[model samples]
Target: MTTNYKTSFLLPHDYEIPTFNYPQYVLPPVPYNYQPYTQDIWSANVIQPLKTKITAPAQCKFDENKYLNLFSGEFNECYYDFEIDLKEIDPTIQSISKFQDAYKTIEISNLNNLQIKCATPYIENFINDRNVNLTYGNDNCEFDDGLLSNITLKKEGISQTDDINFENTITLYTNNIKVNDIETKYAIAYTNGLPSGDYSNDYITKTKSNVDFLLQVTKLSNNDNDKIKETYLQVYYTNDVKLKIRFSKVLVAKLIRMFGYLYWGNDKNIVIDINNSDTLGIKNNSDDPVKIKIKPR
Candidate 1:
């Protein structure tokens, strides 16, 4: 006869393990959204947003280089460096991106606006045919001023909030930008490990605007031609008038090195363009370097 006593098991049947929902952190070694582009920098047709940090020594905010951004003025910005694990996409892409350069994006708004720029590592040689909406997917968000702060990626598995090092997460630089009639607020993103594009704005700046753009370029730098006796060019601009330029049906971008002129038209057309440099050469001009200040007529 078998005793009908309940079999005592090593484990209790009534007690069950609690379920813990782990927050999925998109750390490295994750799938990457691969953006395809040409591999050449010269022939590539890409117009990436310019960097606040002038990379070209030959050109500055004051100077004119078709390869540089003359309209990019001084503003508060930051850079976020990240590494992507793209082995699944391409075996060659590791730690850094396939291309070493940082991909960049910029968004502009009035003082009421917070300009946001997003960047990914990419080759400048790309066709806008398949423009990468450098946006995030998996609960992923697009690049913006507050993006980094919202998404905090610390260590693998589960990481405590305190473990994150803010300093290492981002590098910040704040400058006092003089605001006048219209204060332009900007947010810039500079990141590698994804994809990038290029403005290649040299003597004349090239942008992604499909309409005629009018911007006033002001010379914030003194024509000192520093101790090195080397002349550097720098300038700034306003975005309010660009719309008018577009409506006028005159789509032309020009960087004038000549002299200034006065316009009599009611629609002043403050943004003016004149001559193109015959020589990219730096001239040993006046003892006081010439800094051209552009304003509305």
Candidate 2:
């Protein structure tokens, strides 16, 4: 067995095919550096230096107060001194002279000084002279003189006084009315088909007329006599084509009225109170077990 190993056959070698080597793709350089740029480069080098070197156009300032005071007088100075003895002075002549002096002394420098010192820039100036007749002066002159000949002074107190008095009187009168004297009327209507249990499904119908719907009334008194009142009503019904079906907890109560009375007698007028809760109940099924309780007023 050691000498018989010489008869061997040569077999074809299975070799793997070589793949194509694609060149490594290099990315193009970015236009900007990837690293974050610092603020010193943007502010000092780009923005601040340019801003510091550029000079802006100067803005012209026009002092309104200065202009007005220069043309007028001291800010708070009254146009006319009532305390001054004018009995010996003719008002017409004095007014004429004041007008002349005002027209002559219309300068901006004086106006500016007056504006600087006065709280209000609306200053007035006047000069007095004899032998000239004066009918009336300007607005500022009138204001300074406290002579509201042309202007209508609003009497806020007087206008409000009547309203206050009327409100009080009406309120007092309303405090005496009774609750039951206030009456309200409402009309309601609905159609109901008969239940299948009662008759054949031939659409039997029933209607109720002027049913004495009961209402409950409550009186809320602010004082012993001034009473606010509320009225409530409850209603119920149901729809049945075959057997009567009761709606699931679908009932609503509504307040009909919150009223105030002007008098406590039988003929008293009722004023509706805007603030109160009133409710009414609606039942969709007549056969459904429902209870309506009308409490005494």
Candidate 3:
């Protein structure tokens, strides 16, 4: 019975586990084609084209034939009359109806052709060297007439956006004949941490007792008279903070006195010349140390 049970316990020989076949995974081929990048037209290229014609503004052309330099005076004879004819750069621009001071166009004196006509010789001498440029109107044109269709009239050194403060005194030594006179007493304040250069312009004017017109300050590293002429307010700082100013031309002083500060650039900083003055004096009113090379506006 045991042998029969063992024989019955044995499993069928044909019965076996099933097998599965998985498909092969093949990768795709790498790409071979390439493309180049391109850019569309820029706004500047579209708006402005190369080789485009530009209209130029009319300028004052120098006239050698009409140029005159006369010398006349009583005792101290100096170069008196300096006359020049400024024709338009465009020969076609003729019959100028009106002309005025280019920068300060408000001072219209019914003159356009000639620039300078000073009574005294020294004054003429001072003005002739400056070589002022003028703007004029055509026969049927107004004061605001233009030469080029696209360009606007530009007064080079004049600023329309500046806040100008006008007063009676004009300025201290620069304007007032009474105060600016050689006899008149001028004083400067010596304080720690005061403004210098263009910033000091207002500060120097306000801090001083008799300053009526605006005062400009410049820094001087060397004692050069030629360099001094290059600016209105020249400054040099030392261990002792004292103001050392040298004036040159009386004619220049008078011109500045009448016309106010002559701006060199658009900022309206006054332009000065040492050659315009005759008397050279040095004075020290304060003991403040010299602060050199402060930038001016």
Candidate 4:
């Protein structure tokens, strides 16, 4: 069967063929709407597939559109809030330099005996001393200057990190040779060799292959009178494995570059397993036409 491509997915309503392998890397819609479905075709970024729903509705019918999880490189630089599938990204990365400029200060009470501990992979150590005793108004010390000495930090360096790609942490400890009152101001940042770009935060690239994992559109289809009440869509990606699917009726922003398209046979039985979903229904009007929009995220 010949699948004629338009922009994103091959024309769904009129097209029918055996399970065709349409590569999902988002690309300019091919002017020539046909590609061979070779057996060896496989996308590197694959979202896991789902089982068909049973018991009542043979296929999923919903009034709303949905979305899947795309690894976005946008978030806070201090903590990891989400997990970007490593498979979704090219992991063999080297730093042109690192990112993240940090500064902190800790007031040490009970200086008679004190122990503050921390660690970092960027340097053998961020502190010159790990164990010590002191008085309230006598000792003020900074540690980023002295190290096992392999890596060096600024005079105000407290910890070394690579926020350039992702957030890494540096730990500190207070150590020996102190007399009285110590005010430790850990004013630090990693900036000397940072790559030159507006992009100073962790991110993915346009070069890596991008693919849809799974696309699920849950709809509530009600007969015009006493049948089922129709619903609007809210799409979501299922990461059971990681390849993703885009949905109809809504557009989302993607973190990865766009390329090839995800084509399908006549089977749109793509329903996902979502819990606690807020269901919204539209009166399945027997008159007006309805349409769903699929977008990338």
Candidate 5:
């Protein structure tokens, strides 16, 4: 079955089909105030998906003559924030030369007892102690330049076999040294990168092959006299793993039905797992009964 197409499905619906491979990551938990370290030289850039506000067309029964009756309160309207999937992007890299004019500097607190990992290539004479004081980028060089000699550096060239690509990893580290009573910790990953000549921080191209879904709660339907009192969505996956569906925006929906298109096939049961969410509770929120659509893009 094709796995790169757009299709729509109704929630509270059921289907059975073969399962295919999808990307999975075991994310590490971070503190609320924690920020990731960042540099500009690495090719591993984070992609931010774009979002376009969409108003779903009315799907319930409405007056045919007035056309104004579409807004006559026959149906409840719900707005949802949606995102574009990264799978649709054409992957490419910005040339290394693009960052030649840029430099990233990070302050290392507790420098006396910490190790650091730097991503850029080393220039032998970038730092010299010939002058009493020196400066490079944002950091002031007060300690003797000889301190760099204590750093442990390693390099691994890119590997390819039979014209096929293999794992390519580059890393650097340093030994803890004290200078001017300042302590330095290692540089980790960061959320932003230096300005790109061809790319912007607003959007990102995929660096990995994993596919991600951008879903939105689009339309809510209430056709019965009894309102749906309490409603929440549960997403199920392989091995019965599930997650409660929540949107970034505040949305009011009942039996919500999301509508959108996908590039993949509609025959797969895993595609509709979001529809058959396990019941969160037996309690109903609204006395009115409606069907809400959960659309995935």
Candidate 6:
């Protein structure tokens, strides 16, 4: 009892909890009006995403704004040209006389690489006997009526000239017994690349989906059976990010269709209505894409 020591211990006590007040979040003001979207604002925010995704995939992020910026940028248009030649010849008088007794033959070389084909009912009366004393006339030997029997073409071994590139050649041929009476003419058709069906599935569409870009032909607005000299091509893309990203898939598909007809030697320039039914739904998903499909306006 004399050695008892004093002991003290701490005890738990209850206290009122403190109240917390969180500040309200405020969204930043958008630079443009938020309403029925205009082409100007939408272009800055939407369709651009589609193009950026397809054009530069590695540099693209899922962010709508950056994609839109890429989409809004301009695209380079492809141009190409093709050259053709026609040659004429006359066989020896003895060859023509011998042909009367047999099926006369005329051979044309230098045509193995072109898409050349002749029309129906080839012309006749191309050969005459030496005793007939018939005078050959240039007007009588026209290429427009030939049957186009055989054709061949070879790529001209040369580099690109003045932004002018060689695509492929097209040759037309026919064999007339009257070789001396035949004449030939060369016809050339020109083009300003091919048309862009839609920009949705374009290479850039995956990154910049929401943009609404348009390709306009501002010059050479007529292709109705006339020679085309020069034409203008204009590209329109949106600048908005959110809109661009949201519609990336659709935009990619559209862009693929938009330039479906662009090739090396398509020199036709005419009023092509973007809303034509035949011009719709031309794009599809594929590992490798190619532009094919020629349309007449």
TM-score, per-candidate, Cα-based = 0.13, 0.10, 0.15, 0.13, 0.12, 0.16
How many clashes show up per model?
Answer: 25, 27, 17, 67, 41, 72
Instruction: List, residue by residue over 1-297, the lDDT tens digit for candidate 5.
Output: 768977888665476667888889878988333122332211121111111222223223222231211112232211111122211211221221211112122221211111111112221221222121111111221222122223223322111001101112212221121222112212211111122121101111121111111121211223322221211111111122111121121112111111211111111111111111121001112222212222111
Candidate 1 lDDT over 196-247, as tens digits, reads: 2121121211111111111111111253111211111111112321100000
Q: Report the lDDT tens digits of candidate 4 across residue range 1-297.
A: 999877776676768766878889977876422221111111222211211211111221111122212222121111001111213322221211100011111121111111111111121111222122110111111112111122222222121111111112222221211122122222222211222222111221122222222111211123112111111111122233121211111111121112322211111221222211121111111122222111111
Comparing 3 and 6 on TM-score, the stronger one: 6
* CA displacement after TM-score superposition, residue 160 of candidate 6 (Å): 30
Model 5 gets an lDDT of 0.19
lDDT of 3 by residue, 80-182 (tens): 1111121221232232221111111111111111111111222222222322222222221123212111122111111001111111111222112121123
Q: CA shift at 52, candidate 4, in angstroms?
A: 34
Clashes of 2: 27
Assess candidate 2 and give its TM-score to the true structure.
0.10
The number of clashing residue pairs in model 4 is: 67
Worst 10 residues of 1 by lDDT: 241-250
Cα distance off (Å), candidate 1, residue 51 = 6.4
Give me the overall lDDT of model 2. Answer: 0.16
Point out where model 2 deviates above 4 Å: 1-14, 20-23, 30-67, 70-297
Worst 10 residues of 2 by lDDT: 158-167
